[model samples]
Target: MEYRKFGDTIVLRLEVGEEIAESLAALCEKEKLELCQVSGLGAAGQITVGVFDTEKKEYFSREYQGDFEIGSLTGNITRKEGKPYLHLHLVFGNPRQNVCVAGHLNRAVISATAELFVRVLPGSVGRRMDDEVGLNLFQFSQDS
Candidate 1:
């Protein structure tokens, strides 16, 4: 993985065999990114995605193997327990099936290359586990 920072924005390049989510987490830690928005596209394989069942408060994930084109990768970075936390969604296009599968990004291995852009925000937002929602939701500050 390679990255360059420009102003408050960062451009990340993921090489073949690299895992997308893992690489981003590493970058977030190394750069100490508190809050940021991310978007990207590329080719990937061995991907797993999940959908949350609100009623059950659980996630159902499915793994896909083979080639896929990353149509979209978007989400945000926040802090959970004072550590960098990532929440991302992905859209994978399978040419062989002529269909696209999308969900909360679980994991993906880069088959070719991926280009991601991260726009860092000034303020930090933390996350708290919402018992009612069963998700780590943003925790905002109340100004005095």
Candidate 2:
């Protein structure tokens, strides 16, 4: 992975064999990023995505292997327990099958390369587990 910072934004190049989510989380930790928005595109050989089952409070995930074009990647970075946390979604286009798959991104391994941008926000946001929602919801204030 290689990156350059411009103002509050970071531009990244993820090389082949790199995992999208893992790379981003590591970058966040190294940069000490508290809050940021992420966007990217690339080619992947393996990817896993999931759909959240709100009723069951669970996630259903499926993995795909073979060449796939990353149509879109979007997500956010925040702090959970003072550590970097990432929440991402991915859209994959399988040209061979002429179909697209999209959902909450679990993992993706770059087959070629990926270009990503991170825009750092001014303030920090924290996440806390919400029992009712069965997920971590953002906590805007310390008291909340």
Q: State which candidate has the highest lDDT.
A: 2
Name the regions of candidate 2 deviating beyond 4 angstroms. none
lDDT of each: 0.93, 0.94
Q: What's each prediction's TM-score?
A: 0.95, 0.97
Over 23-89, each residue of candidate 2 has an lDDT whose tens digit, in order, gives 9989998999999999999999999999999999989999999999999999999998898889999
Colliding residue pairs in candidate 1: none
Q: Once superposed on the true structure, which residue ranges of model 1 sit more than 4 Å away at CA? A: 142-144
Top model by TM-score, which number?
A: 2
TM-score of 2: 0.97
The Cα error of candidate 2 at residue 51, in Å, is: 0.5
Residue 104 miss distance in model 2 (angstroms): 0.7
Model 1, 1-144: lDDT tens per residue? 998999989999999999988999999899888899999999997899999999999999999999999999999999888788889999998888999999999999999999999999998998988999999889996420
Report RMSD (Å) for each prediction in the order shown: 1.9, 1.1
